[model samples]
Target: QLEPLPALTPEFLCVLNDVCVKCYTDFAPDELEVSVREHILQDLEGFVRRQFSGARLRLFGSSKNGFGFRQSDLDICMVLDGQDTMDDIDCITIIESLARLLKKHPDLKNILPITTAKVPIVKFYHVRTGLEGDISLYNTLALHNTHLLATYGAFDNRVKILCYVMKVFAKVCDIGDASRGSLSSYAYTLMVLFFLQQRNPPVIPVLQEIYDAQKKPEVLVDGWNVYFYDDLKTLPSRWSEYGGNTESVGELWLGLLRFYTEDFDFREHVICIRQRARLTTFNKQWTSKYIVIEDPFDLNHNLGAGLSRKMTNFIMKAFINGRTVFGTPIKVLSPIYPNQVE
Candidate 1:
């Protein structure tokens, strides 16, 4: 008979000591990529601080989440403290300075990184490495006067509540428990409205108008009405056309919900799910089904005139998202994976 080994006695001091060391050593790196990140963050802070004193720079995105691999680029946001107007000129200057500094670093330069932004706002990306860093000029005046602050303006009770809600919903939607996808259970819950809008007699007026126009020439359609996924159905691999879907439903839900929830909500909306009977090279030959939803309340009424698609999407998301696990969110990132805590 095999002898049984004594059970391990819990060593409270050892555990506490290990925890303290881990806390301190969390960011410490013995590898090149890690060292590079630490060096870059330190350097960027020093440079920016010298130019704009009292400015607080924060690290977020993948870097802050502790999920980034060594190759992940650093994402930084600089909030200028005190009285100062943020203008395009100021943004340009900041970008220029950082671009010049980034070029000086050998690792950065081999990548031939460049600084550029879409404008009105400034964003930077390294050309070679595809690493990106974002900067936000948080003016106290703007925070009080505009909606820019509404999205991610400052730390406030509203923001705290919004974040909490998003985190909770994201957790629930991650595993197949709610749905096998990465959209926020709440957001997916909301997106279902979009699929519903696509259904005949689009639930949303905006979608209705779009559908009507496509159905009959007399129906009115405006250019101001822009839809990101309208042409998606035409793509060879419709779902593949929108690369964002690459994220497991859980990741996509968490990221998008965190990004968009404060400004958007779908209390009353619908979605549809259907399968195309025909297939093309770009399109999947399979008569695979698609879940569709629509938002009747869409102030614009733009999805399209008809609710031609089925409502499989609504049934799945609603039924799955509604299941409560001890009042916590559930997720199934993959079809085969078990539901996990969010």
Candidate 2:
């Protein structure tokens, strides 16, 4: 189905390695940047508590998921201290009120409440930081999603590097913007994790599949099993295939493009990371879409569900081009210095 490339030279492979590493070095936020995000969360939480007492705020999405880019929006989930869940009507009302309250803040502007969204949120621009932010009520699953990504990212340095490379790749290919008829960065991250899981030596173990006892322990949030083996300290003892994969990030990055373009049958299989098995599109009854991606926690949510046929073709073609481009190596240039990555 695809053209195979000749063996790549070590020099070219090193170039690929440096390029992938550059993605992490250039884009991943520093400690102070991450701390600033937390400070903003705390400040917003305190301010929201003035009107909605017991309001607790948390930073989710890329801010907390070890994925950093200059323009990454702050996804903050807010919940009351004693409240377990929020209904639709109350969520809308609170979002509207939150927008009005945020308007009074000195350091914020362009406050907008989008109650029509699946997850009702009050959006605001933090003028001081020059960052866009959103506060959603009862967005429990997104918090769990951030935790899962963070766990995978911290488990292995290669995982983090590969994820950054994938994000950079998608951004370069212009297929990472969901609002512009393409998949989101989160969806692309899921693809990287899935590709890593499906790698021959398995770069990382499936956290949701690992268990301690006779049965997988159940931890439910929003009626979905959010259980995953997060104890990295004893992960080696628990997961049998620990420390097996030792591939360079460059190889994995190229392999990811090849996996999606040459090996994976997007029409037949779904990209699922929760388990170490082939989940078919038919099993999920999502054969309508070519690029089916299942959310780890939300069984019903297909990240690729919103993609139009034209956009799907464009995404697939980008992978095809990526496979050919990465597979056939070329002359090496001087590697980018760490200091100049910015």
Clash totals for all candidate models = 67, 0
**lDDT per model, in order?**
0.36, 0.89
The candidate that wins on lDDT is 2
Candidate 1, 1-342: lDDT as tens digits = 112222222332233223323322442223665556656667667766765677676555435432233444565656676734556677667666655555554534332223353332234554544565555554222222122112121212222222333333444344212213323222333343332223232222222122313442331122222222233133324332223222222222223322222222222221322221211212322123233222222222212222123334443343344322212333435543325656
Q: CA lDDT of 205 in candidate 1?
A: 20
For candidate 2, what is the lDDT? 0.89
Which ten residues in a row are the worst by lDDT in model 1?
Answer: 144-153
Query: How many residue pairs in model 1 have overlapping backbones?
Result: 67
Return the number of clashes found in candidate 2. Answer: 0
Instruction: List, residue by residue over 1-342, the lDDT tens digit for candidate 2.
Output: 678877988866787888889889988888888888899888888888899898889889999888767668999999999899989999999899899999998889999999897888888999988999899988999999999999999999998998888888899999999979899999999999999999999999899998888899999999999999999899988878888888899888888888888789898999999999999999999999999999999999999999999999999889988888877866543444322211
Report the error of model 2 at residue 149, Å. 0.9
The 10-residue segment with the lowest total lDDT in model 2: 333-342
